[model samples]
Target: MKQAFDHLKAKGKPDCTTLTDHLDHVVAATVKAATAFGMNVDVARQGAILHDIGKAHPVFQHRLKDSYKHSPTDEPMRHELASLLFLPVFDKSLWPVMVEMVVAHHKSTRNDTKRKGIIDLDERFGPRAFALHSAEWGSWSPTALAILSAYGIQARPISLTEAREAYDYAFDYCKNTPDGYSEWKGLLMAGDHFASALVHRTYNQTRRLFNVPLLTYYNRQHPLYPLSYIAADSERPHTLVTACTGAGKTDYLLRRCRGRVFYTLPFQASINSMYERLKHDMGKDNPDLDIRVLHAASRLTVEKNKYEEKTIQGHMGSAVKVLTPHQLASVVFGTRGYEATLMDLRGCDVILDEIHTYTNVTRSIVLKIVEMLKLIGCRIHIGTATMSSVLTNRIRALLGPDTVHEVALTDEQLDQFDRHGVHKISSYDDAQERIAQAVADGQKVLVVANRVETAQQRFQALQIAHPNVPMLLLHSRFKRGERGRLEQQLTGKRLDATGRPIYEFNTGQGACIVVSTQVVEVSLDISFDLMITDTAPLDALIQRFGRVNRKRTPETIGKVKPVFVIAPPETEGEAKPYELAVLEASFNALPDGDVLRERNVQALIDQVFPDVDNILIDKDAIYVNGRWRIEKLVHKPKSVLFDALDIDSMVCVTEADQQAYEQAGYEERMAYEIPVRYHAIAHNGLARSEGGNKPFIVPDKAYDPVLGLQMSLALPAFYNSFF
Candidate 1:
């Protein structure tokens, strides 16, 4: 095997040596990792050895040597084509696995690009080079022939004409039906990459096998010991847990789950961090069990492997899954293609963190979906630091009253527990000034806003306000590569090529500012000296507060940090009934004497939101009645309602709009159109006004690619112009 690798390496340029060496190392490492994870040792070994054999093709060879530059018309590397040619010569039973792996090697794990005519084989492998090489291989020296024969394979020849014809057919197909090809290609690539890794293990010796017994036996103590009994004993199908931030909810939920497990959250940023945590935790108990992360940004590979594929499936079958709500939503509602794996969600134990983040309309939609999930016997646990009685009641009504439970700490108890560790600032301006001063003093600061545009504006404002201070902006709108680079620079310990720390602000070694949206909440390990944020519902505020002064500094008195909350926006005109009720309930719930303290905040949350039963019984009828009336008055299609609410409803727009939307990437903005009662009143007056079109007009530029335009404010003009 080494000699074969060496032969291929010699034919390539000096730079190619490093690439080959790196490939060898990766193959070897994969084998070791798989073996340690309890995969079949022989399969793991063989899969690694042959995984990269396709890279030896002349096309890839040239690219690795930098002798070829890619262009729109240039032929690309066809690793799958090379793999397919080599695989048939081996045992045919391994064909299925090899074929999938070969095709997936260069593709995404979801098989985003594997259609026959979508990819140009000639462009990829250099027009008929495979056929030309066949004749050339027959004339190779005996030493080379021996190496090929050792793998029980023979070299095949291909004609340039065949390659050219195949390339033309594929390219034409792609151009004519780009959508179909694009989708197919994604799936094919994913499958091929997974298969190649399995193949590489065939010739490597370092594969590791997982030992289930050892993993299961290693029990790390968790902090939520007292609640375990309650969770296990409750007959409820779901639990609404409201523990303080930093509580080991992950471990608690993992231990309480029955069969398959899924940990879900709203944001991709939080999902990424949770993925790492779950991998580490589950790796302890079931090393061989497939622990997968699923999301738009996830790295799950989909290549084929008779052994590893089954193993992967089996692991997923009874293992743990961590993903964002988007992945789950896609499985449940997506129509463009079938996600056979979604069937796996059935009977799985699901933990939904930060349930409070969903708005009213969204909450209604998600609840209905959860109700359906309940019918299928899925167990759900809702975890958050702040949950209103209304929200809890709504959750129970969807699942079952008996199935909902709460883990709440009273205001006094929480205050006593942490000793008012989190400080609340009264205004944004004061918070901003303090943050600036902190940066000037070389302290790290994190400024969080509720929306993406708000975060950008605040970041730019900070930059202008403190020209010398280094500031970094992060949000979901930026590309993944950009986000990753910024995160690394902000948090990484390593210096850049210039021999200076990657992130430098006015504070020298410690000073830097990260302006972000809600992405900063939960699971991130980075600490900030101070935080300035817009006021959200109390739970969100608490979650944001958890990000500040999280870890103990050498000079700090305790592990807690000061948190300042920007005052809530002032409301005008007739307030929404729910908002008024919430405020009144909060005011009444305040502790007898104190009006502005942590204790009062907790009390207010408890009084207004309370437990599940109070919320459902008290608010459900009103909410349902209001929703029905609004639906009728708007005369909007049910599909439009679902789309506006950002729920999993099948809604299709006209082809013209759809095409334009796709070209402009406006599908993301569709979520904003979902009507929330408060948003409607505050922005559009649609919730309260019944007569004619108001003077609302949504600016074309204001449309978000993800969350549609905030049309509430323009409702009057919109009605006047279109209705």
Candidate 2:
């Protein structure tokens, strides 16, 4: 007998995986995945085994040895298509579902782009074609027999007639049950992907579920006012909470969870902070809980640890997952990997925190996600401090009335959390003296600017005027590492030698100033004595105000501090992100008194964001009502639907150290990263590097640690382009 290789990978180096081992692992994974959803185990196993049978073809083996080279004369050899050759051997009754899993493993049935002359059976399996494919039959014979024996199937001779019959069954199945057919196709893909990514063994369904009582878990660490007490009042899965800051919203969200939880935030920074907090809080009691943080660079953060070398691929079985809403937005956009996401999220409890913080496009997409999740039977829980009645009514409209558990703090409860007093500024330059005096009086002052350039300018002016005071400048423009360290210092805590937190709240000794952008709105836990900010939407202003007097008591509610609001931007274009009408309306609606009440803040949001229909621009309308209509919701665009959020933005590196950028790991390289808009790059004369796939970047000297990207340095002549 001739010696056979016995194993092969579809791609990669020669020896990483064998054909049989791949089949074995995938079969087990598919069975576990399908059985989780109450599917037929035998059918799932048959699909998994049959999916890769054509990989054993002699032509495939020769191509694998040559790393899969193809010539124009040779017919394209797709294992997914080739597997159809053996479909006749299966029970004819099972061909409809089983053939789908085999042939559509690597491609979409609804969006199959390679179906012209390729899927035609007569052209592929004609009399002369059998002679032409003798080598393929020769190599496939032994593996096919082994697979049949491993799967306990009766051996039978495969023929072209049976193959044609199988194709007819699949074609009829697609015509009759399109939606149900897609479900099986998606489930099969999910199982195949999960199993193929497993490094050690198959899926483990024996793991323990999260059965610990949330109230008991919170009791271990005495939270000042446990919101769990309110949440524990009912056992409903869907909830809507509207509570102010420092009211234990996180605990309330968790208390309502009955199964695995998916907690989503608005920003990447906020997601990172929440991940660490949950890791420490929940990890203490359930050390074995699989809590994964999904984000763009999450793998980079964990890969630096030597012990976690094989944990890069995400596992859907994680008990708790902290991520940004962009991850869930994939389902709304119909991205390629959305099938696995659909499997993971179905029947899961999803917490949407800070829903008001997203842009109009993201907000529209999130609502669509809510619509689909409701259809798929996912329990949706939304938590926001500033939701208007109009938006609330729309949410009710989509989710159906009386279906959600709506909960909010009473007027009396909201009054106790009242903190900031508002003072509108008429004179811009004269306000500098007030900030200087506040810093000199041993008070912690915060300055929030509408733009990064404005923040940098304010920070420079403050530094030159009060050089002795300790000051920190923060924004999205800073490197990831520096931003993390700055957040640590601002929060005033770090881990000790034994991994316990060390308190470092300001003690009213030396005065300090923190100049930052809108990044401080969501989840950073710090209280400032005074705040100076520019005019923004009412919802945003409420979130910004939550940072001041955050830990107030009933006695300190009305006596906390004051927030100074600067004049609105000169023109509508100046407020690039926020709607100009919303900003103007918010400025008009502020109470005249210096004492700003928390209850009044809610009224202001209702006035400003009462209806998004009146304020949505043309571009926003396209996303919300036009493209994402109910009928067109599942239409897959040529590109990602969520690509608008990150379009024209690139992960740029300086031109001087392109080599160093390439050599450094993801974490290390992100330390020097700067986010430059495409418009800025176009006007600034920056060029994309020719080295690899790195983004277009300016010279090193263009970026400053304190001032961020200095457009003038790169485009001194065309500096007005940005302004």
How many residue pairs in model 2 have overlapping backbones? 1
Cα RMSD of all models vs. native, in order, equals 15.2, 5.2
Per-candidate TM equals 0.50, 0.84
CA lDDT for candidate 2? 0.66
- As a whole number from 0 to 100, the lDDT of residue 62 in candidate 2 is 76
lDDT of 1: 0.47
What ranges in model 1 sit over 4 Å off? 1-219, 222-238, 284-289, 299-318, 330-342, 401-413, 416-427, 464-468, 489-509, 552-560, 569-602, 606-644, 647-723
Candidate 1 TM-score, C-alpha based:
0.50
